[model samples]
Target: MSAAAQRVDTGRAAHGALARQLRLARQGRSMLFPFIGRSRRFEIWAHYPRHDAVDSSGRWQFYFHVHDRAEKDSARHPQEHGHIHLFRRSPQGKLTHFAGLALDARGLPLCWFATNQWVTGERWADAASLVRELAHFELRLRGPLSGAGLWLGDMVRFYATPLRQMLEQRDAALERHCRRHDQTRAQAWADRRVAVWSSLPVNWPQDALSAAGPLTQ
Candidate 1:
């Protein structure tokens, strides 16, 4: 098959996988229901599942958590209920943050974003490298949260093009920030003032529809 045909097939698969997951999760309650379980309270900064969801091989992992109201930069993400931090384990066993997805109260995706090093305390990777690695971000696990994990992976794959663009924008933003502050990229990368470096809004339902016709440009 042609490369273009392969891409279209992959994009459609991702969209179908994600849509199915969303349907199953919503049959009982909101999509967040599985991950949050029956907890009456979701404390700020506390990782839900009480532990992150890691694949059997410990390669890919993710966790959902809410920020304290006081800690949120309202001007940036005013409506977020929480966000999932996606990571991949390096050969050295260090978890590297590649991308993040923010969600609203209904557990619908709001946007895709990349943050400075200090935000996730991740092993630093450039945008190009991260984008390349994103294709391997599948989550293979078992039990109730397994569906949630699968949904996350499909979300990344489905939004692959835009996510790559977001990462590129992140790198560009970092360069400009460093220049504005007269600091090296490394220095700016560690600056708390540069928490969320780049972000792009997402509407998953519409995106899924578009994916069925032609792969996003």
Candidate 2:
């Protein structure tokens, strides 16, 4: 892995950014307002931003969307409004999903998760490769969503450790499923029953405040 991939950040920046956005949301301008503003009626399974939020470098991208009711893991995240799926794009345009950040109605993150290949139909990559790509995650946008982009990037750094563990757990789960079912890795990857490979909940409001530290100072 590259040195950049090993870089991590305190969540202060993310917490401050989110605090600002939340204040705005209370006044009717949400971080999600940019993407959902034009939709007459936002529908489930429809990815906000249409094409997606590609970073300035075009190598990183993400989009927010809600899954169909049946696909939601309400047992784990009852308040999940949706999730932001992050992807790493190759120069040749092959896209690899690295992680997903589930958020509640107020746009606060609820958890980070890893999914199977069939979930995103992405160019499957190992946890180590995905971890290496983490240092390269960036999304510099200029608009109402600019701060939102920065917050998203900060989130990757904030939860880097858990994200790494989740990815590793995902891989391990896949291996276990393959062995238990006597199926090849490829077959296990395509198994519809195994959608979410791993997930870890975020302890919200309290955790966010703690990570933010003394923002006023």
Candidate 3:
């Protein structure tokens, strides 16, 4: 086979493997969630897309929705299609960790990414706690379900620390950036976020989706 043909063959084989794993992940009989629980210390929830939970902010918000539905259109595909979002809440009723599984058409996770939006409080203590728990959010892949799990694990290991650092760095940079650009507006926004977080109800949901349920449209 030509080099191009060989490359295509390899890609097809990988895709097939991913499809098989996604099916395994979707199987109702698997005790994967319990196994995942043993590897990590956080409550995990897995389910198909809930149209009711879709965010009005489109794909930019917490929820995931496919942007492109074409069969061979990965280039222009949505940010997160066939994947699950993991939420880690602190014992103090604050959302401290957030991760997502970005899956391919076969529902096999291919990449992992972390976000900085989880840290919204002015109190460094709260932000610090969220970051600490995020370090241990592992996504394990074993046997036929290894594709998504391995990808998730890699994402947790690679991006978790970097995302936290970036969030801190971004916060500091935003302070400076805003001061240089529009100090008053930036200060007001910061103050509002601090106040909002400080005044959050003591019983706030530990998960973002649950917390956002009331506000979800």
Candidate 4:
């Protein structure tokens, strides 16, 4: 098969896998809230429900949290339950930002997006490089939330094209921002207003679920 075919295959496989992960978790009655834990539910200014929880292997790391409700910004970032920031580190390596996905109260994905360097405090990776990594992601996380981990990484492939589009747009947004201020690319990458860039409305898993599932436990 050609490389293009291979990428399509990988993306199709990832979509199916992610959808199944959600289904199984729903069957287990764990769904989405389990990761948040009960203790930190309403704590203000907290990383939600707590900190960046890493998988047992310490490779896949993520956290779900929200901005201060009073904090105003673009309408694109409407206040929601919160958003989860995703990251991955290969064996014996350090974590790199994956992308951010916003979730609604029903636990459905609302959008796929990115933020400024200041937002995630994550190591920088350019668009082309990140796009190359997207289709190759195959996270085999351990234990009960194992599927969730795989789902997170695979979701990138499942949404590979848009993910790449997001990366390109992120860079473009930064470029336009830097041009506007006559700042270098590196300087504009840190701009707060240009922080959230490259977003697309949520799609996929819901369609997959409809075709292959009944989401209730």
TM-score of each: 0.87, 0.86, 0.35, 0.77
Query: Model 1: residues >4 Å from true position, as ranges?
Result: 1-3, 72-75, 213-217
Give Cα-based local distance difference scores for all models. 0.77, 0.77, 0.37, 0.66
Query: How accurate locally is residue 10 in candidate 3, as Cα lDDT from 0 to 100?
Result: 35
lDDT by residue (tens digit), candidate 3, 1-217: 4656544443443343334334555664222332242233422232322221222212111223343345443322253344444455334544322544455544434444332342233223334555664434443333433443443343344344444664454346545645765665336445423221111111101222231222211
lDDT of 1 at 201: 93
**Candidate 4: deviation at residue 38, Å?**
4.4
Model 2 lDDT tens row, 1-217: 3544343255554565667667766678765666677789999988888888878787888888987767745334677888888898888888898888888877777888888888899999999988876555567887656767887877777676788888999999989999899999899989888878899888765666676665552
Q: How well does model 3 score by local distance difference test?
A: 0.37
Question: Backbone collision count in every prediction?
Answer: 0, 0, 0, 0
In model 4, the worst 10-residue window by lDDT is 208-217
Candidate 1: C-alpha lDDT:
0.77
- Across 117-155, the per-residue lDDT of candidate 1 in tens digits comes to 888889887888878865655777898787787777777
After TM-score superposition, the amount by which residue 22's alpha carbon in candidate 2 deviates from its true location, in angstroms, is: 3.8
- Among the numbered candidates, top TM-score falls to 1
lDDT, model 1, position 196:
86
